[model samples]
Target: MRVRYLGPPAQAPDPLDGRYVFEAGREYVVLELHAESDGSTLLRIEPSRGSLAGLYNSRYFEQVSDVIPSLWGVVTLPGGGVLLGPPKWLSGEFWELMMEREPEAEAEFEAVRDEITAEDPVARSS
Candidate 1:
């Protein structure tokens, strides 16, 4: 998913290593969104450079799109089995993976996706 950096997380100081990572107001493609225990989420943006690394706090970005990060999430397929996505998807690639791996269930998967909704962080600002 895409997101635009807002700055350091609202609840924290600037990351000591951010100079090598995020650029203020820059848009980034998130590599993953990790579900957090505190009802918050963590993001892994495609690295700005190879020198620094760490999952970023989601509070630092305004969502460019919807992304639901939950380890407990479950999607029932048309078949009798369940589709299990990792608690946190890599580059938020779960949907693609599901469609690719379950061609026969494409319509079913999409139907499920359409039935879900997440509050867009960016929209909340407006």
Candidate 2:
């Protein structure tokens, strides 16, 4: 998936986490998306900038293509993460954690999305 960094949060940066020094308007490839039961979400991205590759809250960027194809089940992800998705949209902290922990995250996500779309042409929203 693709996303564009909107810049750091409006308020002061967190004292602990600091701030995300992302280039505003720059586009990044979303390696993985993770959501929380509380409705919070994080995105794993390979930025177009320096070595800031890591997980950042979804509030940091805007989904370029929000669609996440449905289908798939208890899949294995790195960092000991698990995801039961698509129905949950494009956010699942477990999924993004899995994506970062696993080297083949983007490929795996593509495969699942493709497989689901192949079966059901109409799926999740963007």
Candidate 3:
């Protein structure tokens, strides 16, 4: 999957520090935060459309969920899985950081949205 930067670029946390799984279409994206001894949070992601109610059935998901807090975010199809991180505040913050990293890309996305709306005159009226 292409990783599109929707916000400012920020350094990605260490890979060893967290778990990340992104299943764009099949299910919800899962994030696991592992707090380090140094007071740092490790993050991990898992993509699944299935219900979290039975998440424990999956050893992988269970293991991660068991260790750290899990965050959930919905994703629209054809788009990449949403980045869900622990502590609700980080969600918006990270998105902002990502968008800041790619100002031009964000502009292009807006342009595309405008173009689509313009082409659909009926949409404009509604």
Candidate 4:
């Protein structure tokens, strides 16, 4: 997942070119996951761009799933925060929370992204 720094909600940014970019923000991350009634873990993942403006448009934002493989269920944010679950399963409220960037751990988050890109072919292709 490439880090895209969006400007504002009113304007769109350049096309992601198949890159999955989530908004940079500090949302309530689930430090741990619990088993659901079906025995599968149900985790909340808020993978939104830093802001609406940071993304080119809603269509592009929706396409985020294309870059992320459904089999993988963990996202490590630049700040070392973890987003657990599939992007499509994420709630709208979660996406909204991504509007603000968590500046405190920006460096860490970026580093993590870089590491993921180097290690994961799915992320790199996206």
Candidate 5:
């Protein structure tokens, strides 16, 4: 139930990790479910980013029942808001999937980091 922010400055900031700018001129806020242990679920909000554009470009939100425990449906609010919670059947499915995929996901994430660093000279210098 704990919410964590993810995204660039001016949109989501402070005490949050995992924030990133997916593309220019567009921003998103990613929140993670911290209560889970095996893996975790994410809830993203794209306030001011518009609905159709945000939904198409944003990667922080998805309906992946196989990876999120008990996740059923998401509620979309006005102004590009969203809420994610578990359903009945998929409540524990996420944990199992996360446990199975954590290592691979971590490796993939690290590889992405390395690739980004190699591509961005500024990042490589830092």
Candidate 6:
């Protein structure tokens, strides 16, 4: 998937938020993106036609590449799997990363985080 900034640059009070569009396969979807307090980003995807009503999709972008400080997020497909994306995304390229990441679905993600911390607490803490 290819993502590009859509609207104007971020301003004060909410410099982390940006309007972006992503080409998913053959469809281009609009998304309102906001950098979480924690280092992650929140993507509120606009529902498409014939999509499930009263249910909007949300995706979280986490820091995956450390060498250059990039973010990678995954969105669960309507079918079953997920689509991993935002590869090569950098702060300088698009937007800056916030200091604290958001705590959405913390309980769900905590499980995997526990395993990561258990394996390497020092690295995880950093």
Q: Write the per-residue lDDT of candidate 6 for residues 1-126, one digit (tens) a residue.
A: 112234333444333332233232322222223344354544433223322111112331232222211233544435444433233222222212211222433332334333322444233445
lDDT of 4 by residue, 1-126 (tens): 222323234545444322344443322122123243343333222244232322232222221222333333655445444444434323244334434544534443344334433444444455
Give one digit per residue, the lDDT tens place, for model 2 in 51-79.
33456777767777654444533344464
Instruction: Give the TM-score of each candidate.
Output: 0.44, 0.48, 0.21, 0.26, 0.24, 0.21
Clashing pairs in 2: 34-92, 34-93, 35-91, 35-92, 35-93, 66-126, 67-126
Q: Considering TM-score, where higher is better, how would the candidates rank from best to worst?
A: 2, 1, 4, 5, 6, 3
RMSD of each: 10.7, 8.3, 17.7, 12.6, 14.4, 16.2
Superior by lDDT: candidate 2 or candidate 5: 2
Which consecutive 10 residues in model 4 have the weakest lDDT in total? 25-34
The global C-alpha lDDT for each of the candidates, from Candidate 1 onward, is: 0.50, 0.53, 0.31, 0.35, 0.34, 0.31
Identify the leading candidate in terms of lDDT.
2
Query: How many Å off is the CA of 114 in candidate 6?
Result: 42
lDDT of 1 by residue, 24-57 (tens): 8887655445555455566655454322224676
Error of 2 at 2 (Å): 0.8
- Name the runs in model 1 displaced over 4 angstroms: 9-20, 49-53, 67-126
C-alpha lDDT (0 to 100) for residue 17 of candidate 4: 22
Total backbone collisions for each predicted model: 1, 7, 22, 10, 6, 6
Per-residue accuracy of model 5 over 41-73 as CA lDDT, tens digit each: 333332332221111222333332223323225
Q: Which residue pairs overlap in candidate 5's backbone?
A: 7-19, 68-94, 69-91, 69-94, 70-90, 70-91
